[model samples]
Target: MPGAGTSINALPKISLHDHLDGGLRPQTIIELAEPIGFALPTTDAAALGTWFADQADSGSLVEYLKTFDVTTGVMQTREGLVRVAREFVEDLAADGVIYGEIRWAPEQHLTRGLTLDQTVEAVQEGLEAGIALVAQAGSRIRVGQLITAMRHADRGLEIAELAVRHRGNGVVGFDIAGAELGFPAHNHRDAFDFLAKAFMPVTVHAGEADGLESIRGALFDGRALRLGHGVRLAEDIEIGREDEENTYVTLGPVAQWVRDREIALELSPSSNLQTGAIAAWGDDLLDHPFDLLYQLGFRVTVNTDNRLMSNTSLTKELALLSDAFGYDEDDLEVFQLNAVQASFLPLDEREDLADAIVAGFATV
Candidate 1:
């Protein structure tokens, strides 16, 4: 097991739904805060990081989100945004992520004087800088931003236009995050409509905090290219033993459509458990519906929805999944392939990513 991560690291990986604000390094936060005169839960990076993970897993959703109050607090400036984004890529590179899509609601970053364009440009600068640094270190990583609109807020249309305006410049897609239960996808119809007309790719954070109706809304209304934490879609699936030799699986309409259409499920195991997203089934990693959905041929991709909050890297998430589900190199390779296929990049780029993944995996 000591070398398990080493092998997995040698394998190629793609991240589909990682959050930008949610992946900051605590030490970076502490350092960035000192100059800005910001207060923190704890000044020690180790303690503050654990505080975040513990608070997130504290079993109360209200308490969990309070952790973000700290992360987002420090990310309100151009320097903070750039530092976080720069470190975000470096971390992904260290974890062997070849390509990743980092999603965050830009509206959340406007608490300072930064315009939406400023924030996006700052993050892009950081990403490019990080990529350059990694390349200098003899590694490679490709990262794109998924501009998100907060679902509970009324800024979806504004965010959509912002996303469209930056399409070719690091912004690859649009998404909606936050409170999927009440803020149904239909509420963002105008935004989604505009995205559709612009032929922009979109992913929705549904089937995590809510159930099938939310998933339905995401598909019918948001036209999601991928499901952000769509693990709960397993609710529509019934798995029964068929004579101990085979298992019979029945998918209700929603799950069936998702599986048949190969809509990617951006399932983050640790984040899902921390947020109670998998509570309907059980409270353990083994109880996660990730394996079930993958076995049933849904486009199941692994992610770390909130790396800082969940105290995880995508490698750690995949390691945990392997421990829970006995996943091997082949299984891990399949997830990478799924992500490459579902990426917002053009077909040629996607194919190139697939080749890179294949070559990386072959190294082991």
Candidate 2:
């Protein structure tokens, strides 16, 4: 077992909620934008990185999402998409991710005249190339695309079909992200119905910017197998009595269903704080309901929702949690196992991932 000062970065990890557009290297963004004549807040990569993190820390999901404009602006072409996707994989591998599902909306990249299929193909090519590069470097990594749809847009059905079209190629799952308050998952019922008929695994962004009602819709209307930043489900938990000996709580219908059903909560510690997802609890990482949910047997997994925007990696997020909740190596291992079990891969593949994680942690 790992003792004090153990290196969390060396542990094998699985990333289920990372965003492609939101994980770009600042330097790469500068280079890509220059060629496209896209204006940025600054050309200096360090300052640009700081800008993203600072802008996203506004404690409002709507304000936090505006920073995506700069990222998606530079990703309107095939080359841009390929390069960004390639670097995203490399970064994840370096951060000790053995497997990851990179999610992005293809409809947002059509401004440069590329079709949605072409954009998906381009990203797949980049992901494959990144995997090959990692192998050449004597490291191992695997990835899949979680094709996403913008909740506020009318292309949910089209995006769902696009995801299904590429299901066997490189895509693994489907998600709906973007503003969650005004545009609930029920707005995309047609798309969810189609995906359900097609038997595609779905994860929806709910319970972050919105509350229990939105999460309820995501579960029943979208048939979501997992929740993206479903931190707000804690709203359903009522603290009854607390003392030095023990604390009692009650789970409402939504919370009980999610916990009993073992729906994975893709909790992003830093991003949740930045977007005020955990504001109801407190202002710091210690205030997060992750420990409560985990202690209650909820299938909670850690993630870096947007590495660049949050200025974090899976390793950093784990470290923060460890510090906040006094988590040891065993706790970290459980989190990884939860992520492996919740991954969108096939049963055999998820078993392989779980084995790999177990072996890796055994070494430490």
Candidate 3:
């Protein structure tokens, strides 16, 4: 245990699962909306921030997702997208995120006149600007874009082409998000097939809004290297209590494959509780299967699925998990290490990040 004394913000961390549309600064939203004359729930920045949190805590995934309409509304133009992306990276740097991957669907931003390629270029510009600003402030941070396609939509193959086309730019991976219940990963088989041929890294939103079958599809059909909020993978794990302090867990074939292959599970604590992703386990943080999965040797990584919706940061999520499951500094270090290994960056870059984490923890 080290410098995580009530505040882990200073520790070097890697964020593998952050959403661009879900992590906007409240103040920025107000400024961007005024030019477009968009109607918001509130004009005051502080109240608007609280509004997002309160509205998202509705305990239903469908209700919680309704808050994104306001966010995506203002992000139609090049200016709006650029500003949001720039601020997103700056905020991550401030929060001590050494590396982050921001995932967002470009199809949603075509409501205006801009093309999908233009939207991607605009976001990349903002990310580069944000990186320069952070460097000027004497801190270093790197970020990548995970181009996403809504699973409910029929543009899977098109979006997959877009992602591969821009791979040389800022886009690092491809993902199929949106409603995961009825729209399974197999629905986007063409996209996954394209990504596989291109040798692109893929992370799918599975086991969050669905069950083991969804995760299975993500691995087999989607060829996902990671699972977004795969908290529901625990459904395949059966835990039994023996004596007072003795317990046992049995993993089904699906769970066993995920564990044996060391596929990363991006687990967001507060968001999971807010969206009822962990309802079957329990409604409280203590009832989450994150600890169980970690104990069973799963490559678990902590994340903030939606900072604005959950009103939380990476440090806050880790602290909350520590309080709930008694995780200490060493445990936190292991989580960071896992993220470094699972990153989409090159092997050398990942090794450097791991070294930085180890060095930072040493000082702590």
Best by TM-score: 2
Better of 2 and 3 by TM-score: 2
lDDT of each: 0.89, 0.95, 0.93
Ranked candidates (lDDT, high to low) = 2, 3, 1
Per-residue alpha-carbon lDDT of candidate 2 for residues 1-364, written as tens digits (9 for 90 to 100): 3466578999999899999989999999999999889999999999999999999999999999999999999999989998999889899999999999999999999998999999999999999999999999889999999999999999999999999999988999999999999999999999999999999999999999999999999999999999999999999999875778887899999999999999999999999999999999999998999999999999999999999999999999999888888888999999999999999999999999999999999886
At residue 83, candidate 1 shows an lDDT of 87
Name the lDDT of candidate 3: 0.93
Question: Comparing candidate 2 with candidate 3, which one achieves the higher lDDT?
Answer: 2
Between candidates 1 and 3, the one scoring higher on TM-score is 3
Report how far off residue 345 is in candidate 3 (Å).
1.1
Q: Whose lDDT is greatest here?
A: 2
RMSD (Å) per prediction:
1.7, 1.2, 1.3
Candidate 1 root-mean-square deviation in Å: 1.7
TM-score (C-alpha, index-matched) for candidate 2: 0.98
Give me the runs in candidate 1 sitting further than 4 Å from their true place. Answer: 1-6, 60-62, 241-247
lDDT of 3 by residue, 29-134 (tens): 9998998999999999999999999999977778888999999999999999999999999999988899999999999999889999999999999999999999
Question: Count of backbone clashes for each model?
Answer: 0, 0, 0
lDDT tens digits by residue: candidate 1, 285-314:
999999888887899999988888998888
Candidates 1 and 2, the one with greater lDDT:
2
